[model samples]
Target chain A: MFKKKHPLQSKSEILLRNIVVTAMIVFFLVFLIIPIGIAFVGSFHEWNPLSGTYRFLGMENYKEVFTSSLFGRSMINTLIFSVVVIIFRVGLGLGIAYAIYSPFIKYKSFFRAIYYMPIVTPMVAVAFVWKFMYNPQIGTINHLLGLNINWLMNPKTALLAVMIMTIWKDFGYAVVMYCAGLYSLPSDALEAAKVDGANGRQVFLHIILPLLKPMTLFVVITSIISYVQAYVQILIMTEGGPGTSTYLASYIIYDEAFVKYNFGYASALSFVLFVITAVFTWCSFRVSGSEE
Target chain B: MKKKIMLIAMVSALSITSLAGCSSESNKKEQTKIDVPTEVFGDTIKYDPNVEVNNGEKVTIELWEWGSDELFESLIAGYTAIHPNVTIKLVNNPWEDYWTKLPLALDGENGPALFNIHNSYHENLINYLAPLDIPIEDLQADFTGVDAHIIDGKVYYIDYGMMTGTVYYNKDMWEAAGLTEADIPKTWDEMREVAKKLTIKNGDQIVQAGLNFNGDFHQNYLLGLNYQLGENIFKEDGTTPNVNSDTMKQIMQMLVDFYEVDGVGSKDFGEKGADSFGQGQSAMVIQWGHFYNTLNTTWSDINFGVFEIPTFDGNPYAYNRYNGESTFGINKNAPKDQQAVAQDFVKYYLANDNVQVAFNLAMSTFPAKKSLANNEEILKNPSLRVLAEHIDRYIWPGPMPETVENSLKRAGEEVFYNGVDIDTAFDEAQATIEKDMKNSSFVSVENLYKYAK
Candidate 1:
């Protein structure tokens, strides 16, 4: 009856449909899918940009990227930056959401607007403004604190400085997400916790924290993805300065492709980053699976 | 009901047509016209008469002209009048980003038909460069970069024209020190003495710099002088870095002494090197012939005098580290006729005295050809003549060695800016270069020229 209603297509009709879809799909595959796929394949090969010769040397790029000090350092820098960023951002986001979610806070809308400002601000522009604010000699922070720090230039502090900016710029979104989670929480749970002689801290730890796990996972996963793809902050602030101390995987790929004209190498580097992101994303979902 | 359906479809189609028209119109505007300002070279030359069009090919070539595009467009306008078949489309960007993007675009499948390459990147673009295939004798026959473009036994690029660095001094500041252009110092010691006089200190902070030394200016301050010292940084073979050598150390120390021991360029002053010249923050600065051109445009009324850059450590020839040199090569993939026209245009731009005059006039830079540099009209011109004397020592600092070019320059910046020891900073630079060289696949300059014709 369904086949009769749909009227099983003739061979010619199927052929014509396939031809049209195939044409459109070929366009996409050639333009988008092919480049991305090639990037993945490129990671297994040792290709020289200038010579236009490629050697298929499986796992060497991965080996080199893992063993090379430059890549290793950048990886560590990226991880430390991400972990610190998540902690501060999620922590600050929850604090802000809770404070504002309370009945007593004044000018909630104004505070919300202020919090949203960095989220809406362009990443490049925010990084640039932050660059000056973290300038070694002239930065307002350094001058005010009377602490001599090369915030952007010094290897020791550059990552932290970058992470701080990342947190400030991104936490607003996390806050907004947490707000939704807080609103969705059952008011009866909080009331029951209070009736059980729980303080604000006890209620937060025992009742609110468990409820926010789903929102936290969402924020954390997205934040991790964003941090892995972090290029603009490093580009604008340091350009991976002070001896590759702040070089991240994304910026390395960017510099290789654009600055150094080693597109082959850059493509390979990108695939490695893609794999890392994919795995991390998978693990995140796995960890958050039962909690939801 | 049928009429209503048709009317809705027609309205939607009309809106789509208008949108498409608007986009196409904007693209037409983007494609046709480009404007750019040039540093004011004091001497003005005639404009290019026309783009060289042959056999009425009616060629439309894409050009990625970084700066001075408008002036080039004007010159092309004059050329198009002569040969209406050929049209030139010029696009420009800031010099810094242009170097980054243009190469990738040029190497891409659908990049420009013609583009710019600077001396700093001579080695980097060699493989991508399509051979001009002009035989050896015919190439640079007039010394118009026959050798400059020759790479691994083939012609790859030609200098747009050339300029050497010179000390374009502030006459106003020099006058305060009771020094006339006639009394301009020829040696570093005399220059420093004058600088000490020009140096003004209000309390502790540097009020005005006597001379602005671009810190981390390894090539300009040290390498140039090293060339004068008869020390070649790269072995003629180009493989081994003699950077840790005694001569290198001596050169490094001399530069270090200027900022540290002599104390001329200050960290506290905070005036950037590029801006210090025009802003009157520095009394004397050594930069390319374009500085005079820039001063002429931006600070025309400001009293300034142009002179030769001083020799360091009694070498009698001061080497200003080479930057901002350009080479043009045909796209290997472009049409046959376009290549011929490009070659003729370059030959004309470098050879024809009138175009040389226009280049100098419009761009405030010099004609790269030896013939024009020696021309009495060009030689008599105050700004460019002194720069010509230093041409023998002009080097691209060995094509901006991947090992040394400023990725790590920012790292050692603190040492220069905060008086970090020279040894410490040099070691860091050395380490970074070594690491970069290891990661990089390109052979050293020594190995690169093994195929030299």
Candidate 2:
């Protein structure tokens, strides 16, 4: 049933396709596959690149990572940060997208631009601005609120402060994604719901939400992965301070690899984080009923 | 079909060639001759000032430092003027990023030929450093802190300066609080009293802290207090940390009381002590001598005065512990020609008296060069003069591991932020340090404080 091509034309097209496919394979192998392979192998050894030392100690690095209290604390902190950020970022993002997509709403593009600004801004710059704003003495947050709370210095509030800043910086991304999803939504279902005298809340709850599930799933899974790997804000704002209150699993990986020069242990920790993220992603997909 | 096969073969060849290029670069490094002098322990290689490095070949030596780009620029220009065949490129990273990047950079082929070393991370970096060929007797006679950096007969780098904690107070705030030159406190009790008088509060909030020690407990306060108590934070072996000792608990409690009891400072008063003092929100702060330069550049308008760190009692073993501001270490992994030029630059840096004076003044540190101890530029700085007066009262704690500082800082945070008991906090800090030290190559310099008496 397919159309046949001339021999010479087919040969040229196949040659171009082969070259493109080969180039992509080479790029991935060099950049991604090889690094992952090295990390996997290095995870079993005691490696210090600076000192040129490497010793094989099967699973010892993993054992230490599991036994360390700081590692456990970091895991819990990262989980809490990810869960909280996902909920707020996705929820606020959907609400803002829906509000902007409403027929009565004016200046929809302007609102979209305003909300999408933070996503494009550098995380380091955003983190520094938030660090200053959370300062108790001279920060705008405390000054405007007339409160004396130490947002980032107190152990109880440090992680929460970081999570809030993360949400603010990232919710914009979800907003932009959801806005695109909203634009592509079929108008027939919405018109029918209105024609049937359905209220705004009912339409949103029953029809809009279920239709937007795929977008929501994409946002949630990506958010989970991104939030689990969140460390730049922690590095800049707190350095996991106030007695490790803001220590995330990724931050621990950074500290082990860079600060402590324990590359092997860091590799082990990275693999553990990778497995956790995969599990989290699997669960997200399964719960969303999109596994098939 | 033949075209497809040919494409696959070409792609495989490209990948193999790219990897081969990487392997060949490493092979080149392996084949390169190490031109450094080989001397046995207790032997020294005489340094020649007129030695022709790189045989007058035009070479560029990359020098990496945390900060002080302008100072290095001037020094580099001076060196290049004297030796027209050599060029020096300065790569400056922020202080926090430098430690993390330096090791990774040194591990690779394209690392800098010369890089500044900090004693805190010296042990981790020792294997990558090329030992200096300077004579031991000349180093001992000319530099005060050369003994600490010399291992066997090899000198990685001499300490260019000595820095310790000092009490920096705003002169305007001091006078406003009716304080005079005689009001400068010599003991902790008197200092606390002065701090109380200088503190200004609005209800429960401290608008102006008399003395702030919030985030600087580890760097500026704890070590000094430990010294004043005649205690070392590390055991004699240095590998085993003793941060949970009775003396440490005493000092930790005193630190807590400074905030919780005296109310002269607040845990959340400002982000850091130095920043608070610089912003005119604090009357006094205990900072190292380098803070003098920081304030001079960052907050030049503040009229500040320097005094010796107050002691617990009138006389103690020493008032504080000091660490060295080390000279640059030559990268052994650098190209042979670059290493030769780096070595020559080190010689030029040490022999030039003007460069020595400029470096010490710029760092706001006491000169490691004995001749520069009385140099006009060195003595002109008020903070350096204060540091010089009590320099003997400070003991050189040999190359402290970063773990010690980090653990102590965490301990302070636990006590201040989490309300953890001082004993538990310190015990945790000790455990952390001990565990970290097991993986470290750090060893204490014996009898570092033997002359404190």
Candidate 3:
């Protein structure tokens, strides 16, 4: 029956498909893989800008990177940021996606667009807008809460302040993604769960959550990757300030290369940063694979 | 063992790639032959001892300077039109972005044929520069002041501008605090007392501040203050940092007092505050004459004036004012034999009275030459004279070594923003700067002794 069902495509059509596939593969490898590779290499050498000399300094740059103790601090910061961000993105995204699927909301597409507006907006502009919002003296945040706390200045509160901006800038994308995922899934399973001894929480946890794992994994991995590279928010808001309290690994690498002019050290820092991220990625994929 | 080997190989590969990128970039810069300014026009111009000329077969001289383009262009245009054989091309980069981009830009295809760099940056690019061989007699004959341009008894760039590090304040704000420039105070104690009265805190909001103790400017001034205390931050020889001094501690305590003030705009003096200068957030700031432009542009409606920074108590009537001069030099690589022509252009630019008036109006900068100091049009402008008078008292000893310069800049930023005490800041700045200077891989720090804390 399977053999009978298979009617072969024309040879020209098959050739066309092969060519397109090959082109896509080459494009991805060249554009994506090569750049990352170059960055990896740029992270290791002591580049003398004048007289144009570059000397191989070896693991010394890497040794300095680990010795700095900043990587450890940043790893913790990044983890905290990712975990918190994931919960908000996933939970809020699911809720909004599910609610919007209903007919109760008026001008559904308009509300969806408004919700997705921040998602499509430039991060720099968003960060700036939020920067004014989180202003210590008369920002929207301060005015709304009547808290005079220096959001970007007070070391204790700087991260929290940044987190709020991150959330506002991000949640819209998650909501959009979740909307697509919810639309394509089988609604009968969710209804069946409700019919079979399931309440609201159980409906979500036992049936719908299982099917959402693939989407959840996609969102979680991408968010984690993004959080690791978070620079603009820090750059626009704090510039890794109040004595480097807000410094992420990415920010630290930028400072070493640009501010300090220690390009070799910066390259070394980047190499390690890539390695750490790769390991994190592998661990997440492994978890996803096992659950499946 | 397999995982370890894999890691080792990957690391090795990464290093190779990084080295490859750096080496290739440098080699490309070296291999490519490009036009440099001095090589184009060192000898062709009809050199005028008294006035500059633009002679030499229409040579294009490139100048990469950081300033108001209108000022530099008008100045160049004044000289170029007379000789009719030369044209000046101007490239302007902001101070913050210029340093990072310059070395790379020089490596790239569109790098300046002629570029101006700070003395600190000059060391890194010495190999890339054309060795200027104009005689001192010729240089002096063309200009009134060779001393300002002299680096190690050799001229590097033709000096321009009036620059003096001073405390500039809004006059209206000062009056609101019941003070005058006469009442601007001489000692730190006087400054604080005046600032207390000047501090207009309408609840937590500072309607007007008595001072904006900018840490970066403070650190630069602290070098002068260290001189006042009779010890340099870099000690007698500059081979070592001499930051842990009684006077240094005193300076740190003074800053802490400023930050410790309740509700005077900020606990930290931020870039935001500096940008908000005209908004009545700050009454006074220790800044350079370049700030004249910022004040005029940002706070055009506000009444403001300048004064010398007050004295440190330890130094009895000491003045350690510093100024950076923007200079024009004949590039070592401008076509061929263009030095004479370049000097002629420089001389013409300097001598033209109308050019001087236009520059004064456009930039509000002090003319570099002593001759231009009292030009009728220049003298007529009160703001120009005020700037000129201040820079007249400023002492310029060419440029510091790049290593000392960078370390000083970083330490200044960290100290000011992080609330680090001045002593520790100076100590760290000294230590890092001394190491760089001693290596002589950078500029020599041996001379820093004379300017030490």
Candidate 4:
């Protein structure tokens, strides 16, 4: 440090490092970036996989995507699903994480494991299990509540039912993230607030909450991304059914691409969703306004 | 260092030698050229059970079917026993997953040699299917619903069986309701009354549904009802949505009334409508031939009977909308030898009496071959016999888009589950189906009519 000296590496060693880094960059570009780029390009072309044909359609596919009623409905449903999922995931996650990370709590690891079990379980299996539980007749929920409401069948409840399953399956990640954030929180600031005639709530709101901003951003962005991309749970639980009550944007894209073989339009729809997600991510970063 | 290099060489040499041994073992098992015979089965299919194949070739033909694997396993084993060179593999994907995976699977080089698809998706798959080796005239001579497999004047698929929708009622429930076979419903109005009578309720809850009217097969029933009323839901060109009509509205109204007005069924039944019927919690279900197998296996003690779905009040006949079952086709892109072997297996599979009887018994779907219908094993079951008798009566609903049926099903779901008005549901369904049809890749409705003919 006194001499401002630079350590030198062997030519081969530097070459090896360069090679590894280049390989990683190449891999990312090939596997991730290229496919996404192809999808963007193909959004303007009609892709007929069977005939092995792709005819350029200019902005027609994009226009169709914008005009499609199903696309609009799916977007609305996805927004609702994502917002509801975020509320549950963030609210419950923070509360549980705060409680578990508190000094008064015991068996912290056991509680964390219990909450994290759903996250580890396969979504399909979780979806099916929840679907059975939501069954109107012999379902656990109906039997316990002593009401014969068709949870998955009723349009009013189908999306909410699927959202509950999604939240249950995903909230554990938030809980764990929040717990880590709480553990690493600046205790000195919290103590200062407490000592300055602040109560627990004030200590939490004024000191802990502000300090946890980075973790909240992380959880919120990731949760929003995951929820926006949800398809399998809806596919399994309600099949995006009861007259498309639970149809999400991702589900509609899948239906278009796979079910209807409308790949070009589906690609356009995907790009739209991609743009929405990118915008949300950007907005999130801007609003958070804090970074290490 | 010398010792380490020597050890590496020894290991490499051993690995190569082991690999060579395995390869040689695979190649040197046995080989023989066997001639295929020109013997014909039933004057329709050119199939001989003992027809020689390339002996010891070890060709594994994968068949993707949606039904139970019991009969398929037995048939494949039998085929393997007869022609030891061929190994028939049954890849049984459930119905929904099968349809979703098939189109993608066919895009690859390693797709199944043969696969079954629903008649609904036949249009979507025609380009990918290999035409059956048999002559179209010969196939039509033997197989019922052969027209359903035709595309561009070539038969590319064949049915192992066919199922026409019919009213399957619990005889015990009917008797409990103080009714008999002679008193069976003959008109839509009569059917509703019978359904109401057969249903049993206990304090605002249904103990037994009269007619388990739910979303399952709702479109098929509605289509048949529409037919009875002399209305085709789709235009002559199959993709043009013609569901916005008076006759269609009447049909939807009847369906809606079954849940709301008549209370013969409920949303509580959901997808388990058939299950309720099987368990005797429902008196009746308008189901295809497969209900015979489900009920026989699940509720063997419950007495049951089958009747044609009742006609509209003024219609002279019941409209039986049937779907092809066990519908199979060979992959067009398969290797020539594999495709030939697959064709041989298909012929062997279809021609074999044991396979036919066993498949029918397991699936409760009627044999596609008319010759198999009169088999004592089939005729003994009155329900199956009734279903089989009307095999010729199975109506082909031109090449209708699956979305049309799905949209109709959703309309029923809206009425049944969401308590939406019948007219409102129909209007929504008509709009959705029209948009779907417009955006659809399917040919015009006129082509469907020509194809159906």
Candidate 5:
């Protein structure tokens, strides 16, 4: 008993849909884009949060950031942190995923849940637990190893200690993604390769690795972005101490903005960090595309 | 379609009823008031019985403290009962977060009515605090260390309590290391020898540190040492940092010796100094009187004793840096009525010796007033008794306390971690301090209190 809509009325309905879509776009531009733009502009100014005062100085904040030794050290530390975390997270994640997915393995669902537990655990709780484990005096890690190395205090080991906790906390995402990727791959292609006398490793290396590119790209990109901006663990565990050995860019920015009240300088530092993350993301996609 | 509409109507009715239920629940909020013995309670606090309650008018006062809420819980309840119209909201964040959020809150004109700040941070917050509503003379007359927090001759802060820094030693560890009370070091040189003696090593690993040299408290700890040696790291004007001075060089060298040469404590050990001492891994640690209660409660098995930080020359001077304790300031931006009420609460809080006694007992810190120094509660605690005798020597680090503290830390780290020579470390620290000092929006005044100097 419903009347058929006229073609003119359908066009009007599409126009109404376009208006709603435009409104949503405008909302996003206001809420998201404006704040980011403000931060960008504020980076070129000196802002005192306490006094509610600001003064614009073009390129000065950037210059100071570049010249500051703390900034330079933190940049290098950030790079090391990101690179090491990405490598370990992806490599271990893929290996574990493959092992669990293999026919030889048992208790697959249980193992999957176990691997995903760390991801569900709060980072703050994880950091605190890991801090206790890394404690030089009574930490479980040292107690078990029968060694007296200061895991979180020694400059040589502090960053590595933090990275280890981070990888353990985050790799479950990679596992889940890889597991899904493995499930979606054309099963006959893998079967065909196996029947052609391709051994297990050969089957993995030749067929699976190439086919899991999209999942790898997703995991790598997300992990890189996450690790590059990573600092909460550092803040809780070490607080960027022992002569700034574990100081990362994000931590320095946080300390400057919050602790030191150098909002302008912090903004500039954050913007630089943003650019670095963007370039790394682009490079990741480029490398993936080149491989394809 | 009618069935679907009927189902939607039922769901909507249910949602409305649930929301109404929530509103009713919220409206039924109960304020639990404790029944106190009028005879004892009325004697402790003086309240005007005739003051009319501002009935039907709500006045909410927000309070922020970097401490336990329990200390204020009873007081808030008591105050609220008296002034039923006034609602006191208390937010207690840890020290670090308090400082970070405070500035932003004040800038936004939404700061607490009454908040506590340390003397170290008072300079940075000078402009943001409301002047005391009461007469400045009255406040000074009642509170000790009132001068420490005064800026530009205005009384903006009052210490709710005070405690002085001192070195805490593990008695059991000393005895285990074949030492006794007679071997307590009186000078830095003697302390080094004692530390070396007390240190227990299993191969290359230090199982028991002789003296814990933590980086976190390097500034507060070294300030005492600097004071003992008559060193002012900041000039009289509080503008330039005396970073590369002879005294600083000596101090840096001493720290380096502790880490690299004497091997008394490792950089790692310092990070976990409190824990190390707690677990009997460190023989000696430096902390304030608060640690007395901390040690007793947490590590009661370990026998610990307190002593003044050993001086360079073994002088009789028992000086150490003390901070403004329980120091509360009124938010300059708080509403007039709230600020007035907050000040009234401050006065009421300070006048009640029983409240002070309870706070000190709970926190194990000394009360702010001199009269409470000999209170029975303090006399009962052995550590508090010993600390009481030395409270006179508790000094304020000259000006720009945090800056000086941070510079000392950086200098120590440079010597200890980076292997920078003492002179170079001090030099670099001096340069950084000077640069930072210049960059600050407001400069600290000339040396305010000569407590140690």
Candidate 6:
């Protein structure tokens, strides 16, 4: 029985499968593995591509990145931005998903489409729109609210302003994901909870929430990785300014590589960022795996 | 087994093709080196417009610029019209991305053959620029301020225009405040007095800013003010920064007082000086000569006038430091034929007086050509006219390190937004700049300017 094969599993089919698998492996090696390998190797040198010069510096680039005050500030900013955006975005998305998933809700598809609209919209366009709306004097937010706050220029509020915009533009994605999770939940378990003296709140808190853990873990881990690498909004809106108030680790990497032409140092910074992202992702898996 | 062999054979063939695509062209023929004249313009060798470039081979030269796309397009049109075989392709990137993309582009084989250069980035870009083969004396005789650009008896690029900070006043706001030409400020004290009259408030909120330096203090104000106070921001060695001095503190305090003590401006008034002024939210802004064109193009309805920047006491060592609006440099890494064609096009550009006047006017800069100083079209711009009158009062500091500007900007922010003391800010800035200069390849140009009055 184990040696038996399907009629379609002929020599030509096996050869075709081998070719497809080989093609995919080659593609990944060329596009992804090779670049990562180069970055790893380039991290130890002082590389100036313009002059085609590379001088090995041992661990000097890494040491500088670790000791630099700007990098420290950038890390702190990134952590703050990521943590706050994750909490609010996840919380808001779950609540909206629950509300829309209920049978009592009308025009559910319309509401879902509205929430998903921002997810499909381009980040650059969204960032620009938010930047205009945040203008202190002539912005829609200020004009409507009758307030005179310099949203992007005030150091105290710059990071908070950026986080708010990021959450608004990104929470819709969470909503869509959570909605799919809620729909796929086992109905029998929820019905049993309802029958066993469990109220709607109790059912949701215990049965629904517990079952959605897999989806929640997936959402949280992806969000952590995405937000950790987030720099486009920062680039478009603040440019890490109001004096580096919104400076994230990713923005620093971009600045070091492109603006300063310190590719070696930037590669070192990128590796550090990669390590941090991996550590967080590993811990997330461990925690979720332990619960299972 | 035969099918498996065939599969392996096909995979090997695909892998070889992909590796070949990634490999460099080792088998290609070497490019022939074209001879560049040691003396491009002299008694025997003069610029000839009819000289065939690239040995009359049809060629396309890519030219990159951060701005003045229209001017370059028209120039390309003019050049191609004369030499029908040559096609000049123009690639324009925004100012912010140009610097970041330029070096990487130049490193590649398909980069532009010619591109614009800014003095601030010249130190880093020096290695990539092919020095002008023209004799130093010829450039000195033809262009003004070429001395500052000459390094080791070779000029990489010449400044086609001179630019410095100037006060742009909203003419409507000035008239509304009952100010006339006689009331135009000649000194800082007088400007403050006039600014107070123009400022409008709506119950503790500044509805209109008389003058704003929210974002430009580092570039336009601080860098220029020290020269007026008989001081240079850098030490005599030029490489060592000397920003933590009595003169710098005085300048920082004056800027702080503009918002905190004097009530003439506020940091929260607007995002940038030029944007606020264009929107009529600011009565005055300290901007460069290029703002003249910006206002005409972006905000044509706004009536504005230009005046020279005010002195501290109506007399000083110099008014401000000037930066060269440099011309394009040919890429040394480009193919020999492309480089030759680029050089020939540059020669054609400089030799034509009408083209010089047009370039300067389009950029709103003072012309570098001595012959074009009196050109009627060039003098038509009010900003250039003001620049012409006070051109000698401005000093060219040569190519400054970007670190100097960044450090000063950080110091300004620390003082204004971070609540750090002025002395501490300056000290930190000095320390940062010193470290950056020591680590980088920047060697300051000494005697670029004379500060003695």
- In Å, residue B202's CA in model 3 sits off its true spot by 4.6
DockQ category of candidate 5:
acceptable
Worst lDDT window (10 residues) for model 5 chain B?
B36-45
lDDT of 5 by residue, B1-453 (tens): 323322322332232213333443332231142332232222222435235334437888888888655446556665666567888898988997888788768766678888877656654566788877566666667666776556677877767676666678888778878888798877878889988988988877787899886755465455666656665546766567666777666766677778689888778774557767887778987776667767766777888887667777756344555665645778878878877787777765666565666666555677777677887856776656666766766655433535566666766766666566778767767777676555654343324444434
TM-score of chain B of each: 0.77, 0.86, 0.71, 0.81, 0.81, 0.86
Candidate 3, CAPRI quality class derived from DockQ: incorrect
Better candidate by DockQ, 1 or 5: 5
Question: Candidate 6, residues B1-453: lDDT per residue as tens digits?
Answer: 323322322332232222233322321111011122222332211466467777777999899998655456556655675577898888999998888788888877888899988878875678888988677787778887887777788888998888888899999999998999899999999988988888998887888888898888998988988989888766787667778889988999999998888787788888787899999889999998878878876788899998889999888788887887888889998999899988888776776554566677666778878777876766778888877776767877667777678778878877887778999889888887786665565554436554443
Please give the distance, in angstroms, between residue B139's alpha carbon in candidate 4 and its true position after superposition. Answer: 1.5
**TM-score of chain B alone in model 2:** 0.86
Top-lDDT candidate index: 2
Where model 6 places Cα greater than 4 Å from the true spot, the runs are A1-8, A290-292, B1-46, B55-57, B450-453
Q: Give the runs in model 3 whose Cα sits over 4 Å from its true position.
A: A1-44, A195-197, A290-292, B1-67, B83-102, B108-110, B116-120, B137-155, B202-207, B214-224, B236-246, B259-273, B313-323, B328-365, B375-440, B444-453
Backbone clashes counted, model 4: 4
Residue A15 lDDT in model 2? Answer: 92
A157-250 in candidate 5: lDDT tens per residue? Answer: 8899999999999888888889999989998998899889899889888899999988999999898888878889998998886657888999
Name the docking class for model 1.
incorrect
CAPRI-style docking class of model 6 based on DockQ: acceptable
Q: Could you arrange the candidates by lDDT from highest to lowest?
A: 2, 6, 4, 5, 1, 3
lDDT of 2 at B57: 79
